[model samples]
Target: MSAQITLNARNLSRRLGRREVIRNISLQLKRGEVLGLLGPNGAGKSTTMQLLSGVLIPHAGQIEICGINLAQEPGRAKACIGYLPEHPPLYRDMRVDDFLLYAAKLHGVARSGLAEALAIAKSRCGLEDTGRKIIGTLSKGYQQRVGIAQAIIHNPDVVILDEPTVGLDPSQIRDIRALIRELGNAHSVILSTHLLGEVENICDRVEIMQRGQLIYGDTSVRMQSLGHQAGFIVTLQSPPEPAELYKVPGVVNVEALSATRFKILHSIDANTAEALLSLSAQQGWQAQQLTPLQGNLEDAFVHITQKQPNQHDQT
Candidate 1:
């Protein structure tokens, strides 16, 4: 069975002041999937999040939330989305319980259901015991938890988080990451951040934006494949000339790093280790170490964003 699509955007474009900030970006989010929006500063990641959450109207585009058209029925469409901006909307003077109760009401939760909604939000955000505490008295990490609590208070079908871990310490970042992973189990999540490592750790799929446009969008599996296909590092007791190693089947190119170390570039279908071992025995080049060189998300990000627009789209 196909997964249910909770959020969809097509031809989304936006102009801030005199310059166009986002151009013709299209994306989809399915139920239970965590989609990461990655880019450098001024890449329009924040603007895209605002558009998707109905916080900013697009100059030209269509947004649907849980099948409701945002332009035609903004109230219904926004009802299905929970948004936490870079600086979360929180009332520092109010108690955690009071703030969440207000947020629940603002989202249209009936008076009768407010208690249940508040409980659920607090429990999910690890704020259950701190309900009576003032928002200002909470630590930065707890404050972030409160921010997330308010967003999910209404139990929306989709959640959009912008730079959720910014200004956080190492421990706080780990805690928040765990919460984000937990949120993905029940709702479609859109995470926007300039941090590439976060995307590598938490996202199932990633879309890279560059100079106001989406340059690449693919599953994490496909992104990792880019790195794995780069090549392998092989060490031998007796290093042969680069040409000798290139003679092996499936070997594309060889660069000698030292008398005993060489970098071997090979086809994706090549069993590089097995071929190297077989050839080494025959040539008296005792193999010492043969390891696949893994590629990282940073490499893929650089490769996509550094290219010109006319070069590629949606790889």
Candidate 2:
């Protein structure tokens, strides 16, 4: 693989006992990019995360982390990865500093560099003042920070986080997201989430999985733009009946908001918009305003996934 690619997987597939939970998933994470693994619950997102983090082996396909083949050189490849699972692994009884120290050593940090590594991890996660305190005594937000600190203590080339902010309050979610954005400034990040907001706020690119298969992949901006293809909204000074509006070509549904305003839904064709403009001008329905609706992520997600075959036998 190229040096700029921190992670590269080719045709990865894995089965749990008798059922195939992941199928032919290939993805890449470039240096300094944040990638989102987006899907609904039970869509095999977490399983894919586990496979990418080297916690579970793929039955078919090659994984290269920092150019080292995971199957041939696991130690070197795993050393280049830092992963935070959906559930944060913590020994609540241990003090914050003690837990992180153990984590750094476990990741193979040398004795001479352990102190520096610990300091940097603590600082990055904003845990400088919580070191002396017991981990269990800290709030959920701080505990999550501790979890992140452990992952990045060794400064891995790629960071993988699964549902990192599943249960935090709004403020805590904001803080964690900010920390994640800061991490993306330097490290390649893969975040698995069912939450659309997390994908919108943190991801540069997105790959959507459903029914053990990848359904869509693209830049976040383009994925979001899919929802806008439905139609536009308009306001007229003298509105016509719903039946009259429906008579226009390509117009599918017209939802009246007020006497003069309506939301328009139509087929994916520019002719629909042109017909509306021409009709409005001819009828002297003084077109007061016409605006496109902001795209809906859920709509785009559903639209992309609706065609997949039903294969819910495995999760």
- TM-score winner: 2
Residue-wise C-alpha lDDT for candidate 1, range 46-148, written one tens digit per residue: 9999999988999999999989999999998888889999898889999999999999888888899999999999888888799999999998889988999
Worst 10 residues of 2 by lDDT: 306-315
Off by over 4 Å in 1: 237-262, 267-271, 309-315
Expressed as tens digits, the lDDT of each residue in 78-179 for candidate 2 is 999999988899999999999999998888999999999999999999999999999999888898889999899999999999889988889989988998
Work out how many backbone clashes candidate 1 has. 0
Name the best candidate (by lDDT). Answer: 2
Which lDDT values do the candidates have, in the order given? 0.88, 0.89
TM-score of 1: 0.89
